[model samples]
Target: MQTMRPNPSRSDHKAIALMYLAFFVLGLVGSMTGPLVPALRHIFALDFRQAMAAQWLVLVVIGALAWPAARLMQSWGVFRLLCLALGLMAAGCLAVSFAAGSGYFASVLLALAVIATGTTLLQVAGNPLTTALGAPEKSHARLALAQGFNSLGVLGGVHLGSSLMLGQDAAQGVQLTYGILAVLTLAGLAMFLCGGKAFPTSALANETAAPSEALTSRWAWAGAAAIALYVGAEGAIGSIMINFLHQPHVLNLPMAEAGRASAKIYWGGALAGRFAGSWLLTRYRAPRLLGLMAALACALCLTVAVTQGPMAGYAALAIGLCNAIMFPTIFSLTLARSKAPASAVSGLLCTAIAGGALISILVGEMADHTGLAQAFLVPLVAYGLIALFAALKPAIWPQG
Candidate 1:
C-alpha cells in the first residue's frame, strides 16, 4: 500500500472507483443508529445519557483516533490502512450480530467503537488518497464527486436500516442487518485487496507543504473553534432527531416515519443544500453567505426550542441544509486566514470533530435534566457563535 505515483494507471482508476464504494458503505452503516434511539433505550433499558452514549461512543473514538491514524498512514500505505479499517468494521458488525442479549449493549457499543476506529482510519486514508488518485489539478473535483456517493449512502443507510432494523422483532432485525453489513464490508475489503498496483505507495513527503505562519494566527484558532462548534452542533442535532421527531410535543411520528424523515428531510436537506450553497456562494461573499446560513440555522434552532408542532420539526430538520457547505467553507476560510499551510489547517480542523462527542454528552445531560426542547439550546448557541464569526470575518481575519 505504498503512496501512489505519477500518471495514475488504469488500476489507479479502479482503486478510486472502489474507494467511492467504500465511502458509500461507511455512510450506510453509520446512518442506521440515530433513528434507533428510542428503540435502543427500551431494548437496553438504559437512561437517556447511557442510550446516547451507546450511539455516541463511536464518534468519540473517531475524534480521538482519526488524526493519529492519519499520521500513521504515512508509515503504512493508504490502501493497507483502508483494508484494515474495513476489516475492523466487518468484524464489529459480526460482533453485533452475535451480541444480541439485553446485557450485551456494552459489548455492542465496544464493537461500534471498533467500527468507528476503522471508519476514522478509512476517512484519513481515503480523502488524501482521492487527491493522490490522479492529476493534482483535479484533486478537489475528485474528492467532491467521491463525497456525493457518501450522501447517497447516508440516505440509503437510514431509510433502509430503519425499515429493516426497527421492526417489532427489533433484536432479530438488528442481528440480520448487522450480518448483511458485515458481508458487504467483507466484499469491499476483497475489492480493495485485489486493487493490484492501483495504490502503490510513492513519495508523498514532497507533495505536502506546510507554511509556518498559519499556525501562529489567532484566526486559525478561531476557525478551528468554529469547526468544533459546527461539527458538534451537527452531530448533536442529528443524534436526537429521531427521538425528538417522535416526541408527543414535537411531531409525534412513529419511529419508522421519524426515521424516514430524518433521512429524507434532514439528510436530504444537506444533499440539496450543498448544491444550492455552491451556487449561492458563487453569487455572494463566502463569509457573508456563511453568516447568513448560520443565522438562519440559529433562528431555526430557537424556533424548535420554543415552539411545538410539525413546523418546528421541519425547522429542526432544515438545519442540515444550512450545514451542507459549512465544513468546506470553514475549512477554506480557515486556510485563507491562517499563516499555516493547508495541511496543517486540515489537521487542526479534524481535532474539532471531537466536538461531536463532547457536545453530545453536554446535550444529553441537558436533556436528562430538563427536556429535549431545552437541550436544543446547546446547538442554538453554537450556531449563533458561528454566525458571529462569519459576520466578523473581516475584523478577525488578517487584511491582505
Candidate 2:
C-alpha cells in the first residue's frame, strides 16, 4: 500500500482558498434539484417517479463521467480541468435559462447533463486537491472545513432557488435564476483563469494508476459501497422533503413555504454540523464520529417512518445534521486505508454517488405506492449499512 504523504509547503493558503470557492459553487449548483422539483413537476405534469428523473439524470451523468474526468485530471492538471468544468457549468446554466419556458423537457434534461458533466469534473479534481493541500493527519478536519463552505453554498442556494423557481410564475423565475447563475459561474471561471498559478500544479499529479487498480483493493470497494449508501440516503431524503412536508399529515405548508422550510431546517442543519464537525474532527477519531452520526441518522429516519405530524417532519430534517461529516470522513478514511492511487479511488467514490439516483427513484416509487412516510425506510436501511461499515476494524483506524 502506498501512503499519500502531504507536503506542508504545498498547503498554500491561496490554493486552499480557491478550493473552498470551488466547493461553494459546486454546492450551490448541485443542490438545485430539490428546490426545482416542484416547478419541474408543474411544468411537465410529472408524478413522483417522473420528477425524480431530473436528479437521476444529474447523478447518472456524474457517474458516467467520473472515470474519464479523473483520467483527464491526470493529464491536464487540476487547474486546467477546473477551468474547463467552470466554463461548461456556465454554458449549461445559460442553456437551461433559454430552455426554461420552451416547453421542451428533453432540452432541460440535456442542459442538466452538461451541468452534471462539469460537476463531475469539479468533484474529481476538488476532493483530492483539498486533501493534498494540507497535512495528512489533518485531512479529515480540512476536508470537513471545505465542506462547511459547501454547505453554506447549499444553504443560500436552496433559499434563493426555492423562492425564485417555486413561485407563481415559475417559468420566469427559472429563467431569471439560471441566468443569474450563468453569470456567477462565469465569474468563477474568470477567477480561476487569472489565479491558475495559485493552485499547486504538482499535487496528485503523480497518481498514474489505471482506474482498474482501484477495483482490486477491498478498501476501495468497501469505501465505494459506503459512499453509495450515504449519497443514496441523503439524496432520497432531500428529494422528497418538500413534498413530504406538504402532506396533510405533516406541516401542510405551501410548496414555496415548504421549500423554504426544507432549506432553513434541513440544509441549515447540515451547514451547522459541517462547521462543528470540522472542529470536532481535530479532537476525535474520524471513524468513531462517523459511526455515531450514521447511527443517529438511522434513528431519525426511523422516527420519520413511524411517527406523524411535525415530529416526523423535523426528524427527517434532522438527518442533515447527521449527514454533515459522513461524506468527507468516509472519503478521507478511504484514502488513508486504500492501496490504490488517490485519483483512482476518488473516481470510484464519485462514481458511487450515482447510487443516489437509484435510491431516489426507489423512494419515489415507494412514495407513490406505500406512502411518503414509509418511503423513509429506504434511507434508514442505508444509514444502518454505513454505521456497520464504520464499525469495521480497518475502517476504524488508518493502517501502518
Candidate 3:
C-alpha cells in the first residue's frame, strides 16, 4: 500500500472542498436516473418485478464490488481512484444512452448497473476520506455534512433529469440526459486528476488484516445487515414514492408532479435532517440518537401504511427526515468498537447496500399484489430491525 504522509502545515481546505465536490457529484450521478425508473419501465413495457430487478442489479453489483474497491483505494491514491470511478460513471452513462437509443432495454439496464458500480466505489472511498479531513472526534458530524451535500446532489439530479427525461419515450429524452451526466462525470474526473495529490489519506488502513479478519468481526457483520435493511427500506420508499402517489387511494397526483414531490419534499427532509444530525451528534451519544431515529422511522412507516390520500403520502415523505442520520451513525458506531480492523470491517458493512436492491424489490412486489399503501410495511420491518440494533449494538460481523 502507498504510504500517505500529509504536510501538516499546508492548507487542506482546498482538498477537502474538492473531495466534497466529488461526493456531491457522485450523489447526483446516482440519483439522476431515479425519476426515470418508472419511465424506463413504461418505455420497455416491463412489469413491476422486472423494473425493480433492473434497479436491484445495479445495487447488487455495487455491493459486490465495494470491498475490493476499498482495497483499491488504499493501494491507489484517493484522487486517482476517485477519478477512475468518475470516468467509469461517465462511460456507463454514455453506454446506457446508446443502449436505450438502440432499443435494448436489458443492455441499458446493465449499463446502469455499471454506472452504479462506479458510484458505489466512489462512495466507499469518499466517506472515510471526508472523515479524515477533519477532527477525529467529530468525524461523524463531518460525514453527515458530506452526506448532506449528497442529498443536495440528489435533489438537483431529480429536477434536471425529470425536466429532460421524465415524460418522453426512452430514446427521445434519455440520450440528452445521459449526455449531460457523462459530461458532468468527465468534468469531475478532470478536476480530481488535476488536484489528486492534495487530499490526505486515511490512517485506518486495512492492509494488515486479511479479508477474513473483517469477516470475523461480529459487530461488522451485524452492522452490514443493518445497513442493508436500512438502504432497502429507504430505496424502496424513495424509488416507489411516485408510483405510490399515482395510485387511486393515495396522492393521486400527476406522475411528473409526484416525482417532483418525492425528490424535493421527501429527499428534502433527508437533507435537512442530516445537517441537523451532524450538529446534534456533537452533543449526544450515537446509540441513543440512532435508537430514537429508528423508532421514529418505525412510527412514520406505520402512519404511511395506515393513512390514505396526501396525508399518508406526506407522512412517508417525512420519514426521510428520521432516516437521515441512521446510516452514518450506525457506521461510526460500528467502526468505533472494532479492535484493529476498521477498514475491512467497514468493507463488510458497505456490502449491506445490497439491501437497497432487495428491500425495494420486495416493496415493489407487495405493491403489485396488495396496494401501494401496503408497501410501507416492507420498510417497517427494516426500521424495526435498525431500532433493535441501536438498542442492542450486536456483534455479528463476518469473517472471510
What is the overall TM-score of model 2 with all chains considered together? Answer: 0.96
lDDT tens digits by residue: candidate 1, 67-140: 57756665676667888989998998888777755457877788788788888788766765665677644443
TM-score of 1: 0.85
Top model number, TM-score: 2
lDDT (Cα atoms) of all candidates against the true structure? 0.73, 0.86, 0.76
RMSD of each: 3.9, 1.8, 3.0
Clashing residue pairs in candidate 1 are: 2-200, 2-201, 3-201, 3-202, 213-339, 214-339, 214-340
Error of 2 at 31 (Å): 0.8
lDDT tens digits by residue: candidate 2, 25-51: 888877888877778888878888888
Which residue runs of candidate 2 sit more than 4 Å off their true CA positions? 1-7, 395-400
Superior candidate under lDDT, 1 versus 2: 2
Residue range 239-262, candidate 3, lDDT tens digits:
778787777787788777777887
Off by over 4 Å in 3: 1-11, 201-207, 393-400
User: How much is 234 displaced in model 1, in angstroms?
Assistant: 1.7
